[model samples]
Target: MRCSSWIRVAVASALLVFTASAASATLVVPEPSDGIEVLVSSSCRDRLDVSLRIDEKSSPGELVFTLSITGPGSTRGDLRGFFLNLADESLLDGLSISGPFVTGSQLAANAVIGISTGYTAKSHRHAGGSSNPFDLGIELGTPGISKDDLQTVTFTLSHATRALGLADVSGQTFGVHAMSVGKGRCRTGSCKLTGVIPVVPEPGTALLMGLGLAGLALPGRRRA
Candidate 1:
């Protein structure tokens, strides 16, 4: 193959990776199930409309959550990150749930160093009401956003599930009791933003996937 052809392939691959991992649509936050019995303060739940999901079929041993707000999103503060105390840790994969997964995508490039100071991994919280410390206290980070803007963030947990130990993880139930977020400077509407990323195929990915696939059907140059 010609060098130029290889270059095209390299560029194509890079775009695919970014397209696959970059963003997910904003989901309306769902209400916790009565069976789960973990009570996140009503005030927190009221602050933003949210939706949760556990992607057990498409991805196994991983919990995928999309928390979003409708219309103009809200801002409570600087809005660093969000958290949920695990009522049960058995759902988490002990080894795979750390590093970049802990921090937001913006800082994932330097996760190892970013985690310690950037945000809390799995720790204690009293302000929310003295929750138990973990085997699965997970925190997900976010790239900062403007107050009252439409924005959405998706969390892909390495090893978390809701089939057992709690209510079934689904649209009907979240299986969580407590939740919190870090808003360093902004408070009381200082930093809060939410929205659903539209589910349309990105133009770049569409062209790449479409043209690239069509290219495969055509003849290829023989190796030198």
Candidate 2:
């Protein structure tokens, strides 16, 4: 009878731990389309690299997502001038890109491509003095993302401008254009941007799981 009780407790505890570990994360971009679009002085030369961080409470190493970029057929420009910054600041930046994914005829009907990067900025070209707002479209794959994980992305404009030499615009303000998908279509709207989200375990849930595990272990010890 004692052995059976111990086994039951152990099994229950293991189940609780497994469930807790499998808890889902959430990602939210609480803004309307028409996102943000900031106009930096022509003096800004460095291109911006973007990356997204999911679940700040969880190590960035644990969160992964596939990123792709596409553009309207009317959009014709060389994206090689920009790159993505994927360093320790993964939570700060979205994902980095190097070289143009679309060119000439490839820019039609919107195309998508994948991107990845590590620490430090990879050498790339800086936009010239020309004040052109390049329109780059992004798409994120939602296979493993959970509904509870906190998600935020950052864009780091690294490069020197003729006005500001070797400037790192890590915290500089920029405009963002917000957009959303509904009924299998995308729409743009004016969005009020805010700060990033923090992720952490629920205190009550953590406590309960801990106690359950302890109870199971105690029964096993007594049987021994």
Candidate 3:
């Protein structure tokens, strides 16, 4: 009977470890909307290009964006490129940009941009024409983030400029329709942005395990 009891205890302990490992391995996005949109500008014209960086806890992941622009001027741009890093000042390790496309006199600039791997939200800008590019970056910390925690980074633009023959200039209104990034590939027809899951373990889980081990080590003689 003693041997069988010991065996059962061993099996239970092993199962507990396995269950914890499996549960901890899976990363999840708790928010219903995988993506969040951040408005960057209300108006830009004369070929405006902007670049922004997104900071994440994980080493490598994916960034997806849905860009929208509205005005008489026909122009559109993608997420283009990104730089990521573990620290704020560290040299950028990975960078990626999307292929450029012309809006072709369309009323709106709507498109998707995808990026892979390491990047930092340090400095960003727009490329091309007499228009000066804008720089933007983001900082990330470990407060509410856990292995299962997922967050959305959003970018938005809402304005445009038009040239009115010779010295005349005109401005139009626009806004960000949507912006987001996620760990896994976005499924088709999904409007929300998704971000990659961080790899850190949950503090609560670790604390619970520590308590369990302490309980198992308690001596019956001491309790009595």
Candidate 4:
């Protein structure tokens, strides 16, 4: 085929695919459900937030998980360590934790992880408050977050793969259970906590859409 002919075909194919994708079924996020919550103390908040969300860009056998914890107090930059139990334990390697928190495990496993939250080694726990965005307390070797204010700590992990011991989690009923967190004035492990289960779209739907796009982009000739 001529260069101009090939170019025209490519443009037409791309436009057709784009239009089809736009008109066809597209993923839409559902209404937010009340996530799990925990308690700080009798004088503190009624509930603490422990939320989890899976990325829509997850591929086969891999998942992208983002977690956040909204506490009842601030002022104290106490670095809280939230111990969570993932649905797929082997896939733990795929997650990279961030925020005013640290991973119970390695930061980099088999995923292309990126983080831009707060961090302080257990060695410099209480001294690195000025280094973080939240001039809060550092609880490394010192006191944890104080009371009387609402504090939220969140983080994102991208490109989480299921190579270690898992696979695609699409509509597979995954969960993020809050096991425990760092110690502090009021919010301790003794505080009561509830787990959250965020839902994801079925993998079959995503896969069919992907196959359609692939077929459009790379159509094959048929013999008569």
List the lowest-lDDT window of 10 residues for candidate 2.
Answer: 1-10
Rank by lDDT (best first):
1, 4, 3, 2
TM-score to native of every candidate shown: 0.35, 0.18, 0.21, 0.32
TM accuracy, model 2: 0.18
Q: Can you write out model 2's per-residue Cα lDDT over 5-71, one digit (the tens) per residue?
A: 0000011111221111232322222222111221211101112212222221122222222111122
| Residue-level error in angstroms, candidate 2, position 56 | 11
How does each model score on lDDT?
0.29, 0.20, 0.21, 0.28
Off by over 4 Å in 2: 1-62, 65-177, 180-188, 202-205, 208-224
Give one digit per residue, the lDDT tens place, for model 4 in 1-224.
00000110011001111121122322222333222122222111223334334433333333334444444444122223333334444544445444434333333222211122333344222121111111112111123334312133444433454342122332122112221233354334312222212223234544444456544332232111
How well does model 4 score by local distance difference test? Answer: 0.28
RMSD of each: 19.4, 21.8, 23.7, 19.2
Tell me which of candidates 1 and 2 scores higher on TM-score: 1
Candidate 4 segments exceeding 4 Å error: 1-79, 93-95, 103-143, 146-150, 158-190, 196-224
Which portions of model 3 show Cα errors greater than 4 Å?
A: 1-31, 41-60, 71-91, 100-224
Q: Name the better of 3 and 4 by lDDT.
A: 4
For model 1, the stretches where C-alpha displacement exceeds 4 angstroms are: 1-46, 71-79, 85-95, 98-116, 120-124, 127-130, 142-150, 159-224
Count of backbone clashes, every candidate in sequence: 18, 29, 32, 8
Top-TM-score structure, candidate number: 1
Write one digit per residue (lDDT tens) for candidate 1, span 72-177. 1442222233434343334444324443434432222112111234444432222112222222223344433442222334556553223332122311212121
